[model samples]
Target: MKNFLVHSLLLAVLLTNSCGSSKINKTSNPAVPAAQENVSNQAIVPAADQLKAYLPLLKGKKVGLMGNQTSVVGPNNEHLVDVLLREKVDLKFGFAPEHGFRGDIERGEKVSNDVDAKTGLPLFTLYGGNAKQDSIVKSIDVMIFDLQDVGARFYTYITSLHRVMELCAKHNKELIVLDRPNPCGDQVDGPVRKDDKFKSNVSFHKIAMVHGLTVGELAKMINGEKWLENGKECKLTVVPVQNYTHSSIYKLPVIPSPSLPNHLSVRLYAALCLFEGTDISVGRGTDWPFQVVGYTNPVYGDFTFTPGEKAGMVKHVEGKGAVNYGLDLRNINPDEFKFTLKYVLYFYDKMPDKSKFFARPEFFDKLAGTDELRKQILAGKTEKEIRESWQPELAAYKQMRKKYLLYPDFE
Candidate 1:
């Protein structure tokens, strides 16, 4: 089954890659065609386009940058650090986010501090042991953040930004955010975290699961809305993208991280991430993480699905080939479809070998933000019933988010 799925994915990739070159322009609002037309006329450039704007401010000051592989100059594809080094912009040090400076590590993997091979400067790992802002920001006059975010609350990179921003505010250091497009764009979804809820490293802000703001806009919202620690705001400057529309999704020239190779993976991550706390292997070791999930259970053969006339038959036995299966669910509406813990619990309950499924109570609770979801799942509640329990909170969150929205709404 693994081989079959791989072959199917390869076929899809080959077919999609055959299309001719086309420019991916940044879009604003897809709901209103007139608004999209208005945004397109301005012809917004990427954050890298405004490199010259920072040169004057950066001169004679110790500068620190928080960026990864995706931080590059538009059109030329030059690394931002290398460009700054050539222009002699007083680049003091480098800071890496989730996947380190090279963007090679897997999700939740720890990165260690190291020297960059190309620039030979100290690269500090903000995603590992010593991730505190004071540990990496003491000697720098200003800190610039420019990492690509997948626009999901669960994604750790944005939390890193929030932590650094708080520290910058505490120390009174200037913080500049080189904005990029939110891959998910302006379509917000899911419940917002409450003030009394656990707001740890994974969730730093009180926004929805899919907050519809760019990093720059987020900075502004944080400051303007007073969402920071003790109601203190950072001295922030957002280098806004020119002509960027909320509806556009850019095909990044450089891969941001190993797991997120393409937009398809990003799209699927929102739903599949729920399985992270479960024993299911969401294709981490394979080429397509989040695209395929399999387990070593023996009953996989019991659930057989035919793929393309005589393409292959997936057997029910677990472990490798016997348990391999793929899902083609582009037709599902992400916003309307309700997801709850029961989806996972029901599968685990029905599996013949329940011991094969590992359930870490703490880990699952952190991922879902409460043990109630897990407890109810374990108690055999259906997905619909579980979703109904959270409806009131989700509805209240939706109303609260309206005041913070930056784009105009059609509905």
Candidate 2:
């Protein structure tokens, strides 16, 4: 009776939070209504919450998790690590990506191998390229990947996913991906990555900057396309999100990382992240990271903010201790946003010294997955012209993406 009552209550909230329709409405931010009302006929259940579907796969098998702070389950957003331990799933250890297991560690900081304090489980650092990943994979019978991805190429979690997939394939181990709804899954725009020469941790696969697929679908693509070394495929299984389509506007219950604190920041990430390669500051140390972009010049904007050292949130602050002037996009309508280079282009044109605009042109190319964008911008190409150049490759990528989709597409 107690269990029944709890399940019933959660179900009610789930239904309320969901939008049962699969229609695409690009004119409004669906997050607004979804957060306010739970009136849908069905609940959008993440794969992690559907324990019964995966618990059997773990029965008597030693398991390890490639997860972090966002790897949670249920309406209350309980950590999957805790739930797995409670269920006696024989969880061996954990693999933390860029941010440490708890998401406390700041970006670009080296994540060292350590023991999780609360769980007392060993954690292998996968962010900066661990030397022991081969042996780590050998120790586990099955690997469960449940990190929340914001549907952007440069997020690094997906890169960790690719690394894990490769190791699992190399070791001939089964891999399970507990899928979650990508908040930015509805929009699929931007440049497709070129060949291996431009590949880095951020742009691991030859996918678009805003690749519109769940991690499960991406896992499938990695295997189907034989992108793995020696064309080997991991024994893959994806426990997909229930009642979710590409167009589903699912608000994340937990912040995916330290930098992206809210839906607005996430909505603006793919657009602003490109600025990282430039001198522009994407509000790193401010209260609203990724919600604004500025540089240490008055000509950039009238609104001013000085970044400072923020422990656990930001270290190695960009434009730290200096007044930065640029656009404040905190209140911009989410519906009006699309993945575009107009912001970067605008900043470049406004830059007093165009050479200094691309402070790290090479890094920018890595983020863009090609150097053509930087070259195009230097040549003073319009946004329309740049977007048009991507059409041939983008169209081809769209067709290729169709084979791996697990749900209804936004288009």
Candidate with best TM-score = 2
Question: How big is the positional error of residue 62 in model 1, measured in Å on the Cα after superposition?
Answer: 2.4
Regions of candidate 1 where Cα sits further than 4 Å from its true position:
1-37, 41-44, 129-136, 195-197, 298-350, 353-358, 379-385, 399-411
Instruction: Go through the candidates in order and give each one's C-alpha lDDT.
Output: 0.58, 0.77
Candidate 2 lDDT over residue span 1-411, tens digit each: 223112111100000000011111111223222322323447898889999989988999999888877777788777787788899999887888876776767877877777766667787777767778789879989888888889998888888888787777777778888888888999888899977778887788899999998888788778777777777777787777777877777778877777888888888899999988987898888898888888898998888888886645556578999999989888887655668787898899999989888888888998899999999999999999999999999999989888777676788
Colliding pairs, model 2: 16-38, 17-38
Candidate maximizing lDDT: 2
The Cα error of candidate 1 at residue 387, in Å, is 4.0
lDDT by residue (95-127, candidate 1, tens digit) is 777656666555555667777665577777656
Model 2 alpha-carbon drift over 4 Å, by segment: 1-41
Predictions: Cα RMSD each: 10.0, 8.4
Worst 10 residues of 2 by lDDT: 11-20
